[model samples]
Target: MDRYCRRAGALALAVTAATATGALAQDYVIGVAVANSGGLAPFSQPAYDGFKFCVDEMNASGGIAGKHPIRLEVRDTRSEISEAVKFAQEFVDIGVNFIVAPPDGDPTMAMGQITSPAQIPTMTFAGTAPILTSVGEYVFGSYPADNQQAAVLGAYAAELGYKTAFLLKSPDAAYTQFGPAYFGTVFEANGGQVVGEASFTMNQPDFSAIVTTIQALNPPPDVIMTSAWEPDFPAFIKALRGAGVTIPVMGADVLDTPTVRGLGEVVEGVVHTSGGYPDPGSAHAEFNARFEAATGKVADTNYVVNGCDILGMIDAAVQAAGTTDAAAVGQALAALPETEGIMSSYTFAGTDRMPMRSVVLARIEGGEKVIIRREMADPATMPAP
Candidate 1:
């Protein structure tokens, strides 16, 4: 503890903390860091269940490497970066073997700093910042970064023959800015044009004014793209439809919330690009079945599948390395062959933490979320770094 504290500056200081109640010396410890409530709940909660479900299944199957049983230590971050920081220090002090990081980019990146300093392997499902690739060797993410998501959406629009589009985003959010800048690059490169655009203030309740502006665009576009989150998500869409602006709506992964899915039939022609989409005969089917039985709920979102796959990835890394040593595990993880998981096939590049997988495009039709296709975020359309 004193050694880690000396190494710490603004980073969390390791303090003596008791671990979980299991007495076995060989128990593999995994720290699940999540936000069970607050603004991030919609994304984090299902993800928590996914990680929990996978751990339980692994334990039941006799644990990793067919010997050491897994143990879990969960800390609720409540969607706050401060809380996430505390969890990272506490998990290290308690001697966790690895960490399942928070489901958002900002906190997950911050969490990685603490875990990396402590020599713990940390992987996340929702950290999408392109900068995440440079978070050192100890941290990893299963999804492509925001720029990747933008590239996929842009190319998809061109494939759908949408010649013109209108993009709506909040200037206040960094990811929103990435949406227009990156998506616009690929869209125009593919012969599409942006006719007009609108911006909304973050957290503004009434989008009626914004919707009016969209409705009045001269020569309305073939598609309308929005960069918004949950509470704002439904409000904007409902207002758009109410104002009779029915051009096909496109959005990034932020729209993968109940507000949009809850709209069902009322929400038509809305396409969302996500990490994974529900599909028949998917590698995740067996796990999804067990998940429903255990929790009485289907794995409704990719975060759920992503969470389960997070553990699968660690398991692969452990097997490839043949040891739980954090540094060795990271080295093996970076060199792992393409392995199929519930959400996608993960293959790590030696230079960065981002995994290579197909970007999933989903559509809302007849009031249900359906997987449309597994597509690549082509390198050709990637936004300039």
Candidate 2:
């Protein structure tokens, strides 16, 4: 059975049955608008599942602060911004206390335009663009900003004694556009050189010209870096390797998808920043075990923990504020102390809505992901968004 199909029925009962009987008085009515089918589904589905998993655990533990049971209403946005907006407006009309938004920025932003003015705190599980916070105070992002991921990867590459780097940037989104430049800035600051730069549109059919350009460099760069995701990334890597280019490649969290894992040996030694890795004994590993027990499926990506972390923070904020008033809850969320989340230790204390969290760097070897290290990016090196 589809896990979401089963959970959807239970969610309806939890939302309506308890209130109809007056059995749960202090309930947190939360709205979820995540894509279950569409281009964003690969990332959003697991994240939505994680949110539901956390909701199940919290309600089983007697809910937030042991008294307030959560009532969830979920809608599939199908990766469309219009659907996201419509559902967000419905959530506002029904006066939901909080919202879990879609995975990508455009939908999240559209939802925020509705929810923020209505004073509903909205959190996006995978929208990492730093500017998402500009939507309003009610909006928050669970993933690290693009610059943060770039800083971590670039700093790690320099630490590995890579003296020269080449960047392959994409014009598809802010994530691709800014991430490569930010990486270059940090790499140069660390005494490394950016030997060359190139740009490609998302899903570009050919990389032969780019590969030739890299090969023709007077002294080849020690490593290649990029922030492209999905089909584009895999295609680029395959073309580079197929053309006999052997330079190591480093990237941001965009590489943390199931598609990349399918590359197997092609991705060996590829380094990238991630939300978190489920190494044994880690909090993420523990959560994954529970997730499997609860859903009968293993998480395919670290994005699962991104949703869990967002909900956990919401729980903490609701408890701390002692009420679900949007202003109070929003303030509490922004003021949360560093929390040990399934993803990592995160806090929103000093900035907009972006979480300051440790970045996990991982390498693929033998068709498995191995953690290289976890570190906080240098705030001084974080490029301006």
| C-alpha lDDT of all candidate models, in order | 0.78, 0.85
Give model 2's TM-score versus the native structure. 0.89
Which digits, one per residue and each the tens of the lDDT, describe model 1 over residues 1-385? 8877667732432222222333243788888887888767787888888888888878887787655688889888888889998999999899888888776667777888888877788877576666654555688877766777878888889999999988887776556656776787788988999888888876778999888887787788888887677777788888888887778889888776566888855478689888876566767776787789999987777788888888888889899999988778877887877788777787785426677677877888776767787776666567754
Top model number, TM-score: 2
- lDDT of candidate 2 over 1-385, digit per residue (tens): 6899889999998979987765756778889997888767888988888888898888988776666788899999888888999999999999888898988777888899989988799988798887787888889988888778878888888999999999998776767877888999989988999999999987788888998999999899999999888788898888899888889999888787767877966788898898887878988888988999889978878888778888889988988898877678988898888877887888888878888888889887776777888888777889777
Once model 1 is optimally superposed onto the true structure by TM-score, how far is the C-alpha of residue 105 displaced, in angstroms?
0.7
- The residue ranges of model 2 lying beyond 4 angstroms of the native Cα positions read 1-22
lDDT over C-alpha atoms for residue 118 of model 2: 86
- Deviation in angstroms for 151 in model 1? 2.4
Model 1's alpha-carbon lDDT is: 0.78
TM-score of each: 0.87, 0.89
- What candidate 1 gets wrong by more than 4 Å, as runs, is 1-25, 171-173, 264-266
Q: How many backbone clashes does candidate 2 have?
A: 0
